[model samples]
Target chain A: MDVDICGPSIPTILGIASEQVHASSTGWSPIYVQDNFGVMSVGFMLPSSRDAIMWRGPKKNGLISQFLKDVDWGDLDYLLIDTPPGTSDEHLSIVQYLKESGIDGAVVITTPQEVALQDVRREIDFCRKVGIRVLGIVENMSGFVCPNCKNESQIFKPSTGGAKRLAEETGLEFLGAVPLDPRIGKSADFGVSFLDEYPDSPATTAYLDIIDRIKQLVD
Target chain B: MDVDICGPSIPTILGIASEQVHASSTGWSPIYVQDNFGVMSVGFMLPSSRDAIMWRGPKKNGLISQFLKDVDWGDLDYLLIDTPPGTSDEHLSIVQYLKESGIDGAVVITTPQEVALQDVRREIDFCRKVGIRVLGIVENMSGFVCPNCKNESQIFKPSTGGAKRLAEETGLEFLGAVPLDPRIGKSADFGVSFLDEYPDSPATTAYLDIIDRIKQLVD
Candidate 1:
């Protein structure tokens, strides 16, 4: 479920932005891409993609609460809540709403830069204070292999050792690092799985490895 | 004013994270970077850099309102409000609160990618609906010049002609593009001015040009 209410890009990234949520006797049905894989986002309810959701914290919290209560998410192994950066209203709302239900842990994603790592550190602290476990840290845009020269460039130079060092310091597992691949963003924009399209890419390999680790930790 | 309550970073970026806001008879004093320039952020109020501010929208809005009223901003030529991404509470609160005071416009900063551009487009739509003028768009991380080969690479590849095309498509001014210079982030993290640190760099040149354009537009 895409809980990033302000900018719900899950629909866009999942190639389901055009789909809408259908309400029935059961409840609001999640638009399924596959028989088992289903998704829900405020993006589906938008009159238009360009329309801004000019909602305040309380109203946003209401929608999120309603989303959990109303969405007919059937037979789910795990309900991952994708949030935007920062530990604000949406993050608080989800945690509070799910306190009884319980959140397994949070997987922190950060760019290979001190600036972003700083935020991730704060997020980890937030997880601790809120009693949520941090599964691990995943470094993204760790390095970019120049398509022309094949020389890897630390595009977002991790001034402070990036997520690996961060995880080590925090005593958490370092999931993996995904190299900078422009095609990954393109695939996301087109709503296609990068893993499926670029099966042999380093980024895909890294993502798969990270996915495996997360599965082992959670499952 | 740094209105990103959950993650106020203006202090860290300005290299003044160690300083605290001194409240006296005149109200809160903004930490000065120079003789003329001063900044205020919630970072200064933090007990520590690693602490997370888990505030909801209403509480954040209240603090923002208090900041505006309590801060001893004396005489100001222009009060710039730096906001986080998304068209949510903080965005709406600022617009609503400033509607009576009259806001000049918004300076939208974005990266050279469709994903970021999509958000910029939504933000512009938000500006229109909120009756705020979009001064222009400034694209950051447009390209990276490899240090070894000195060959330019569109690191965050402009899959759709970057922000220049988006500006043209939306009938907004394209201020400039700041090439990816990792030093820029380093400088910000350390609270030093990248322009001053690397006076001869192309990123500095782009920033100076963009600053000039923004000054002309805003003034």
Candidate 2:
């Protein structure tokens, strides 16, 4: 379920923004995606697309708790949560609520820039402080390929050697690097996955490789 | 001073991450930048570059209060705060603390994409709900220019007509649009303003125009 309450982009990203959430006798049911992936976001509850969620920390916590406890998430092997970028209230609330559910740890995402890495380092520290395992780091937007010339450009120059170097320093496993594919944004806007749309794209390969690593880690 | 506690990007953007905050008789002093712009961010107080701030709402509120009350701001013409994306705890805390100070209003920023505009509309609503004036909307990353071909590309594609259309729909003043410049990021990394570095850039001209409008509004 997508728990990034403030900016719940999952519905939009997955092209299921039109889908509505329905309440059952027990709790709220998530919008089903593909075969087995059921997704839920505060975006579904918004009045309009232009509406903003101007809520405080306690209110945010309340919504998060509802998503966790009130959602009838049937039997599932994985319930991946796309959290907002930070180790703030949302992270605390989620960890606290799911203390007994045995969360598999956090898979932090970051770009190859030092500015981004600096923030991500804190995320790893947060996981450790909260007794959550550090799954690994996935470097996104690592490089961009020019549509015209097909030449690769490091727009966000990896001054600090990207996440691999970070993994080495922090003793965390280096998952992989996902290059900047313009198609990725397009795919999100169109409500599809880059992997499904561009099956042969390098990003798709990278994602598959990352999934393999995750499977091994979980197993 | 940038009050976005969880993800304070000001220090990195200004290329002044190395500067440290010092305590004075009155309170904590802000890091002075070029042209007498005093800056303060939680990023300055971090132990290391990689250290993450895993704080909750109360702690964040405490820090925000300290930044406002304990900081030796002295007298200034403008004390612009670059808040994090969303109208959450930070926004509430800042507005609450600065209630007596007569905050001019909020100058909302967004890109020309439905995805971004959707969130910004809520921000405007937040300002209205909290009695904070809606200064206007500034569209950032409206377009990008290719260095090789020098052809402008609407990378984010203003599918929803961006802030101008948003302003038109909401009956609010449309500020202006700032084109996406690669140099902007580079300048931030190098600790300089794109306006100073690339004075001839379109972005610089747009910034000047925005400043003129802001002067007219505030004065």
Q: Supply DockQ values for each candidate.
A: 0.69, 0.56
* lDDT at position A109, candidate 2: 93
Best by TM-score: 1
The 10 consecutive residues of candidate 2 chain B with the worst lDDT sum are B148-157
Across A15-130, the per-residue lDDT of candidate 2 in tens digits comes to: 89998889999799989877698988998888776566878788889999999889998888888988888888899999999999878878989987777787788889889989
Q: Model 1 over residues B50-129: C-alpha lDDT tens digits? A: 99998888888888887888999989998999999999888888888888889989999998877677788889999999
* Backbone clashes in model 2, listed as residue pairs: A52-B122, A122-B52
Candidate 2 lDDT at A115 equals 70
Q: Pick by DockQ: which candidate is best?
A: 1
Instruction: Tell me each candidate's i-RMS in Å.
Output: 1.4, 2.0
